[model samples]
Target chain A: MTTNFSRFEGTEDYIVSEDLRNSVNVAVALSKPLLLKGEPGTGKTLLAQSIAKALGLQLIIWNIKSTTKAQDGLYVYDTVQRLYDTQFGNKDVSDIKQYIKLGKLGEAFTSEQQVVLLIDEIDKADLEFPNDLLWELDVMNFHIPETSETITAKNRPIVIITSNAEKELPDPFLRRCIFHYISFPEADMMEQIIKVHYPDLENTLLNEALKAFYWIRSQHNLHKKPSTSELLDWVQALSAGGISPDHIYQELPFLGTLLKKNQDFDTILRRVHNRGTGENQQTGTRIFRNW
Target chain B: MFINFFYLLKREGVPVSITEWMTLMEALSKGMAASSLTSFYYLARAILVKSETNFDKYDLAFSKYFQGIETPAQISDQVLNWLENSLPPLDMNIDLEERLKYQLENLDLNELKKTFEERLKEQKAEHHGGSKWVGTGGTSPFGHSGYHPGGIRVGGASLRRSAVKVAGERKYYEFRGDETLGVRQFEVALRKLRQFTTRLEGPKDLLDLDTTISETCNNAGKLKLVWTRPSKNSVKVILLMDSGGSMGPYYRLCNQLFTAVNKTTQFKSMEIYYFHNCVYDQLYLTPTCRQSESIKTEEFLRTHNSDHKLIFVGDATMAPSELTEVNGIIDWGMTNDEPGLTWLERLAHHFPHNVWLNPVAETYWESSSSYTIQLIKKVFPMFELTVDGLEQAVKKLKVRQ
Candidate 1:
């Protein structure tokens, strides 16, 4: 438990808040599975990759789906394959060990060095799925009754679980992990994140884009409010389009890149249209007076 | 002591279990807090709080226990009051005849849709009191105020709604578990009904290892793999909710419960129907209880088997005649041939495993003036709609009565 582990200060590509950095470090230090909950595009899954890259460890990602079971992450016994081979091939059919395939968790446990095991979108699985993995996670080992074998962790691979919070995770499973909520980055932090993505971008364009981006996010009725990833993509589009700062707020050149949903698109467009007309009238009167 | 902080979190409605507390202690022992109060706050939160929904409560408890710690700055109540009270000035200029002529000319839906988009692209700035651009107080086919014949309102007064003020408050009272039954809590409670039963005759999707092994051995070492359908939660639900009229007070609670049930993936199938005051001959598909959108109670009972768990959500407080007398339903449009009590009895007898959840408190049940509640209670097991009551009801639903 007192082993000296490398602290995660966040990778150069990823910008993390102090609180989140502390949470990650504590989870790593205590060798507990860190449970990250956040909005869809807040880099919950990417954090695991960042940690893996920062620590120079192998990354094992287990993407969970609705049909995914806890046992699928441990080991799978291909009995059907073995049976098919018995009739079709000349291989040793009696050896059940040949049929056992190591899953993502099993690979991480058996790895030569400590690896980053990322269980991505764990809430996509059944309600009992997390509960089923509780014993394996706590003991850092799982039993294979078919082969009469117990696979124990070689180095207790650092576990990082990310959930979209689609379903409430069982309390017992939650108790065994270190939890952190990755809040949407504030303007200052978001600026840093945008800077990381576009280092040579114009300051005026960045400021205007951030202003418009944050304003769009402020609207609560959006079915899917633009997040960090969308902001980055929108900035890339803006920088590529070579749109001026003045026209950015006026026309909002690439509104499609920010708002994804049709309803959101319509809502923002209508608001922007109304805002634009007001500005046009003021500018029109100013020109008329000057003339 | 930091232990006090744990108790304070519990008091603040964060369900910080002892296991999580011990984990925090272990982290602290490892010097994970780094001897900084801010660091400790983050470290303790990571260990003790599992969900972001509880983070606001944890923050409240943390600031309360650690007092004087720099909690997030909150917006003043005066500012919030000012924001709430300050309504946008309404435009008084109304040219009714001109508006009617414009509307009549632009009545074509296709033309309106095309013009709206065209106007949006052409408009450059917010034009208040304009007739062409998409701005406030415009007679154009777009904008908010100064109505046109077929104008598409861009935004309303609610456009000023801000999430910053909400975050500044940090109350998150809606997410607090102790305050009321949230949809999440209801979903958790309803999840207990997921008792999976694998049918032997269904589509084979899962590998039946035990059967395969025994069969292979019986076939003299020849490998025989068997597949069977995976065990699934076979619980079916029929949710009959009493809507409108007296049930208006508990609309939010009933809606939350309905949303929870609708969200829960455990049940094999679910059917929801609405009624007003009491169940009569017909049940409406919608909460409005319209005569056109209804199904006969006899047809419903005949179609749905007794296997489905019947759940009735209503206050169950109505006029005694509404429950006992014929044609006593509160809906003026239609009359019931049989009393509500007879229908309740029929439903109860059909579905042996049934429960009624009353939004009204249990104490109010005995001293209540309404005889309908007592009469309904005799037909079906009645439970309060509280969290504890829901858990007990779920447990009761599992058992065959």
Candidate 2:
């Protein structure tokens, strides 16, 4: 039987490229988890929310940490709490299910309506975590030993797992999901993103800021390049301050918004300062002397 | 149609399972993905690739099978075109036969430096398409984006490989030391050092149910359980890695090794340190740390026990002066009369078990005329940074017993 999920859930504001659209569609129709890899602040996490919002599904996020075990996503048994209650004598707490809590995965799986399950930064967990999660994800069911019950998905959750490439995921875990790498936006795309974020931004200032951003981004010395979110933040700062784009070279303090690392800031500040004092060249002009 | 794609990915060490391949076929059959090649690629990758680590391999295999589906490099052509300042067309008529005849071999680098300085003063406006002035597109002995054979590339991307010296503001991202060593071969080589012993109690004390059942059966069905914790290996590893400059080429490989060794259950303690070019007065815990705050080499030697295995992961390819000469630390201004070789010797003498794992091929050690490699070879036994080499090195450590 052909799986039909043709409804366009994403909005025009999401600004998905053809590649990303195909990836999302294939994920939806197949009812498989989509794995997104990208640089930090490139909106790997936001895509889940956007898709959930567009599809009118409840979003259940499982934010993973280094200590996060695979079982934590499905459910957590409060054995200590149960033991304390039994020993301290508050009430007759014979049933362990009273202390049992349904985790994000359980919540998503048990929901009668379709839900979006976001496993954010799955790489942060232990090496065995992804491998341990394989059976649960494949079967869409997990056994709760405490309650002597099993959790079967009433409606399969549209799973979206994100990774910052901090660690390599096990091959067995990766073989199950659909893979998509969200590329950092180009200048034109950046403009569209800015327009969506700040609709009232002037074209001239927008162009100037993007040009400066790209120039700094191209520099080889930066520890961390400013992301699109940082660019929007910088734009917001400029708009709030009522600073025109032409005087960007003069306004050095606001650069803190774009550059997070001290070394990157120092390097860019020196380059900008040198250009400001040494050459009266237009801000938009290429800085390369020979080219 | 997709079976070939499946086998190709598997052949490239992607670990694609038959079940996953069938799922991909099922998805494609259901018209879940669009018929376009790009759509098929995303669909295939999503179904076949189980882990993020193999994404690079999948992409490589995908491109190998389906040519030209991958997007061009993310750096836009518009940026490059805008950077290309409008210039006058090349005047072929300008008689530059006399000037162009100057051979690269005939001109000394020192003399060329002086000539470049003189031209730098004489050049006024940004000249383009001219033979006499330093600019783009013409036969200029200086400046980049021009047809210059054996000339100093001042700015712009490298057009030809014949540059004497490159002068420009180039940025370098510090190598991420946490990258995965994808191959399980390295892990297998690392496991040679695992000397496990049973511990009575720990956090994850695994119950030996089989042993317990057998004992219970012997004791007339009364429960007699056995609990044991996995023992950690006693071998402590001290990894001193060379970062920046010539070491940049082997950054990924070194990172893989570093991460692999870190993840291995064979090591009880693994301490990693970063050094640039040659091991001098100090070594930084992290790459970004300031030199002044780095752990002193003297204190480092005093702290670690002799039982700790010292592994120096560097090419040992540097200017001979950096190893043998006083005040030869390239970046640092300090001078020591003892020399870097002496420091290496002292460490080797103190720690009898030491191995220098060089990413550079052993054949290149002698062929490349690396004098520093010879000096380092004298201090510590060298091994090629490969699976076999690591196995041999680990074997050598065991042989010392």
TM-score of each: 0.74, 0.67
lDDT of 2 by residue, A49-143 (tens): 88888888889999999879888888988755664575467967887788889889999889999999999999787666888898888889999
Report lDDT (Cα) of residue A113, candidate 2: 97
Q: Using alpha carbons, what is the TM-score of model 2?
A: 0.67
TM-score of only chain B in every candidate structure? 0.65, 0.57
lDDT (10s digit) by residue, model 2, range B146-167: 6655676555555564662311
True contacts kept of each: 0.59, 0.46
Residue-level lDDT of model 1, residues B178-258, one tens digit each, is 445677688878988877889635688788989988998998888787888988889999999987577877878888788
Cα deviation at A262, candidate 2, in Å, is: 0.6
* Clash totals in order: 14, 11
DockQ of each: 0.24, 0.27
* lDDT values, one for every candidate: 0.79, 0.73
**DockQ-based CAPRI category assigned to the predicted complex of candidate 1:** acceptable
